[model samples]
Target: MSTTAAPAGSQIAEITSSDASLRRFLAGLPGVDQVGAEARVATLATRSIKTSAKAFALDLAIRMIDLTTLEGQDTPGKVRALCAKAAHPDPADPTCPPVAAICVYPDLVPVAKDALTGSPVHLASVATAFPSGRSSLDVKVRETADAVAAGADEIDMVIDRGAFLAGGYSEVFEEIVAIKRACVSPSGGPNAHLKVILETGELVTYDNVRRASWLAMLAGADFIKTSTGKVSPAATLPVTLVMLEAVRDFREATGRQVGVKPAGGIRTAKDAIRYLVLVNETAGEDWLDPDWFRFGASSLLNDLLMQRTKLRTGRYAGPDYFTLD
Candidate 1:
């Protein structure tokens, strides 16, 4: 697979499709000091955000959420309920902003789309054999196209970590390129935004996380995501910090800004605050927007709503106040 040019007028790093070139680029990236990264995240986690700052961070986190439901038991009713929650997370307070997107299975795209009609919230679908990229290239491409046809505004595709771990750098890069191509509409225009999931929990090291982040960015991922939520240790603070650094460095190198989504296991207002702190300090204030940052979570919204209620009402609100979806 030859290196393709970045979308017209977009700022993207120039990368050769050759395996040797890709290896050199990966090798040239600065080595991540795990201890240093961990220490930094710990220190940032301690930053005292209170009162107005805490309130701002709370709402920002809500808007940055990619509310998700990916399960074998999902039905249209379930998806519609999730979509309603995404549109109005807190019905008690109209001030609460809707989440950035509602993420679901490809087959549920139409269900979510119709539910989200007349709202700004986007519909996202996980494709390319989510949680495990153990399918053929043709299958992955077809899955992406089907999602787009069904009305998904974004596609979250998981990379083949088995191949990446096997030192198949070129294969991983080519796979990303192929899926990126598949994101185009049938009418020959841009379709869904592509988010490449690295499943960093399975990558096992900060160094691998950094490398995978760049590889996905080089292949034109609109966003680089961290997990699928099926594995343990998903979306840890240290892993997200490294990815934030990767996006920061990639922007410095190519002038193109790629978003980051830390999915799974991030379920509390405090946990969400820690991640917001990491983004502010490492990725800078520029990434504070929902467009550049997102949290892929299912149960996280309820917690955020509960906290928001506390902030507004001067007392903690029970879970019943928020929708159970």
Candidate 2:
């Protein structure tokens, strides 16, 4: 629930004033040891929680979920159903906590907004040419502004991977800044939170992932996300560790805290618990809250629900017990 002011324009200008300066700053970032990172997460995955602790971890994971459904065939009926599920993840158990948010395409913002109204569950819309990040800046910004106008509580924008990989760091940086501006509501109320998707699968290396994480944070992204869920090898544990380290160190250096979301390929209660362990081990206990961490998956919620039922009722629920949105 706490908020940190964006870095001053002067501070951003010093590092991003030109392509050469931005390149130098990114180059100065320490390299990531792939083996060490993989080994650390592998070890952490083995640490098991006891009965009581497992129960708590399961609930925490439920609260951290950004229940998402993004598909070309999506319709109002489906989105509304997803919204209902997000607000009350387990209808049979009133004690179950709602998910953190509901993420959908920009065109369906109004449907999700109407469905999620009067609930604490947030409404997130993916913009800036989601999953591909190949569009004009003007178009991207306009889409973002339109989503905000349509009652989106958060904007999940994709970074220009082509520009970033081609060493056009300034181009990617400025796009994020422009989209951040578009998140501000025209009514001048609180700005919609911005979650910048790095799409790490296409970045190709741990060092590049580290650099992109920093660039997104510098450009005023409220949260740095791992993937768009459309790419292969999305949200690997090693990539997430590198991102967690970047956010932890960036806060120390700039005094501004940013959130991390690893979307795609993470399913089941076991996978969720391992990620919670990673956040605790790498970023400390502060990021354990739902505000700082999130899982962007549609099927992950069903698994979490089944696990919770097993823990509470001493038996596993049938897969058909829950609706498949």
Question: Which candidate leads the pack in TM-score?
Answer: 2
lDDT of 2 by residue, 1-325 (tens): 1112224445667878788888888887778878888889899999899798998999999899998999999999999999999999999999999999999999999999999989999999999999899999999999999999999979999999999999999899999999999999998888999999999999999989999999999889999999999999899888999889888877877778899999999999999999999999998899999889999999999998999999899999978999997
Report, for every candidate in turn, its global Cα lDDT versus the true structure.
0.87, 0.91
Point out where model 2 deviates above 4 Å. Answer: 1-12
Relative to the true structure, candidate 1 reaches a TM of: 0.94
Cα lDDT of model 1 by residue, 1-325, tens digit: 1121222223233344478877877776677888888887888888878989999999999999999999999999999988988898887788999999999999989889889999999889999998789999999999998998888889999999999988788899889999988888776555889999999989998889988988898888999999999988789999998888888877776778999999999889999999998898888999999989999998889998888888888898888777776
Error of 1 at 281 (Å): 0.3
Candidate 2 has what TM-score? 0.96
lDDT of 2 at 315: 95
- Per-residue lDDT for 201 in model 1? 86
Error of 1 at 6 (Å): 17
Clashes of each: 0, 0
Candidate 1's C-alpha runs over 4 A off are: 1-14, 187-190
